[model samples]
Target: SGAPGSRVLITTRNVNVSRTSGVSEANMYQLSCLSDEDSWSLFKQRAFSGKSSDDYPELVPIGWKIVRKCKGLPLAVKTMASLLFCEFNKDKWEDILRSELWELTEGKDKILPSLKLSYHHLPSHIKPCFAYCAIFGKGHVFDKDRLVEMWMAQDSITTTARQCKEDVGRRYFEDLLQRSFFQKSRYFDSFVMHDLIHDLAMFICSGDCCEVVDGKLSSTSRVRHLLCRNERDFRRLLSCGCTDDLLKSSRTCYCVGDSMEPDDVDGAFFMKAMEGMFMKMKYLRVLHFLCIPEITELPDSLGNLKHLRYLHIYASGLTTLPESVGNLLNLQTLRVETPELNGLPRRLKDLVHLRHLCITGDFLGLTDSMGNLHNLRTLEVQSDKLNDLPESL
Candidate 1:
């Protein structure tokens, strides 16, 4: 034999990045957050292991209060618990529980200084990618593909001849994941950031690239990404003629809200407004309808988005993509969950940079042009009536 087998092990902050590095889920290991009881146990072992429980019974209650504030984060618990060795007093313990560090200020926090150090240690390329994740609301679950596509759209990912932008974007995601900036979701096939980590990102992006709309759009034109929480807020923002200004300078515009039945009554009018509005968004990279279920078709002007990379239309009502969809040569991810969808245009092949495609419908079949998507990496099709596989695939 002329060759030999090899094994490699890697440690990263995010699990998805570990998977991206070719480690199978079955073989991967996860470090779970410590439970409340276990968190106290670890803290006690480190802080009080040598002291008799009966010796410092007065400080027990205050210590418990302080530990609970750590929210079972081992590092936070450990950091707070270590303070006991230097000054084990009721007032000191109370001060930690009431520490101002719990409040995030522009990414600075005293509670978990070590975690902040980890955040600071991140490479320059991944720092913005992590900070941009603040665009998603707290506790919201998102997939790896969507985030990577958005990074590519933001031009955070660099491409080479052997790899496309999406591929490079994925590497960026993995870098963050391996470093523990992201965690796997317990309820969905997605990932969620720890509450403290999310706070860090939110603080970093504050008044910078990400803004969450409540009733009025910010006057600053520097807002590159916008998030709306509900339909009322969304409509309120659009009614003020904010769309024209926002789209002109924004790179990512999205709605993140609870699901609602498609707004059939106002759906057409909203779609028409968006169609006209989107034609002017030449620099737009991400356009998402969030949970709006009633949209049926993308505007014909969608092709004008030369820099578009991520397009997500949940609960779409249409059956086919417009032929102009072929014009989005830079598109990397397209996720359309439309039960009514029956087919895709053959022009899909024109999207040479397409990397991830997730569609749900009753498909006639895939086009032979699909084989032309040499850069495609993930294809998810949910169809009950689809039986045959395209030979070109």
Candidate 2:
């Protein structure tokens, strides 16, 4: 206490000890985990690191689950990621999504319970930050200051994040990240949580969460998202008899993002397969159907979505487009890449509100139909080598 220059690194589980020791004098550098992207990147660095061939492309998406479980903590990422390097394949990823997920996620205590034990053990004042994470699930990423703003929006700051406002909130987030509760990206701008950590957060909310039985749905007010991935909880919504209520209550639905069949991701008709899912999800405002193989035609229901602002069907095998695209009066971003398929959808001639229209793959049909998009700022050119690309240009 007498020494002014004494730089001490205290490692105690008790929040009071650290609080009393440096409350007003010493500077605090709350540790956090690797950022979400970095956590996944680090996790994959080893898994995909020396590997080559076309398989790398398929493996990345499946690896996302494992990344989510690490909650962006480096220790967890380092430990569990070590397990992935040995089993680098789509089958391994599918296996991870299986029953043995628990062992792989929590096997290294540093990865799951151990990291969370530190978070849970924090002072009562800072507990809300940890508890609030249950809504986003593990592996989910959020901006630091933005998360602080949400806490303010939720009024959690009054009870918790009260120190330096933005700084305290940032410190709180940083502390969690450093303590390995939250993960930071290599870029150090964003954060992520592992999937297992997401489960742990849900467990923390047991007081608020209802036991959603199979064929039964549960009612929740404060919570916005429901995460029942593969726990035989399929028909569970039906049992609750409040599926419609839950739908209106939730702004977004969480489901298995990865398609069971990897072939669908690279094949020529992947867009059609994804279109089937899009047609059923009427409430979705933002949908990322990345890496579809190909689409010969667009689903007609797309026009029905007057609320759709962003539609991403990138990295696919695409040729022609559905005329109904112009019908989406609210459309802002339309992404399609069909380099070999040379043609633009004629319907887009009237989509004046669109700001970005990207085409990467072969569009064997498009010539100069894009001139209609007067408001577009960004565009992806798709066509064979030509003397003059868009005649309008």
Best by TM-score: 1
Q: Tell me the tens digit of each residue's lDDT in model 2 across 167-234.
A: 56676676556444566756568887766565666666653433343444344554344544322342
User: Lowest summed-lDDT stretch of 10 residues in model 1?
Assistant: 105-114
Q: Write the per-residue lDDT of candidate 1 for residues 1-393, one digit (tens) a residue.
A: 445776677877778888788898988888778888888787776567567545778877777776776777786776555545535667766665665555543333422654554565567878889888978877888988778778877878766778766667788887676556777899677899877778778667765555456667643646777777666566555555665656787788788676544542477666776677678788888988643445666678878888898888765467667888899999888888788888898799988888888889878778888998887888999999888768887
For candidate 1, report its TM-score. Answer: 0.68
TM-score to native of every candidate shown: 0.68, 0.41
Consecutive 10-residue window with the lowest summed lDDT within model 2: 230-239
Q: lDDT at 197 for candidate 2?
A: 64
- Cα error of candidate 2 at position 160, Å: 31
The alpha-carbon lDDT assigned to residue 119 of candidate 1 equals 63
Candidate 2 overall Cα lDDT vs. reference? 0.55
Give candidate 1 misplaced runs (Cα > 4 Å).
1-115, 158-175, 212-214, 218-221, 261-265, 290-294
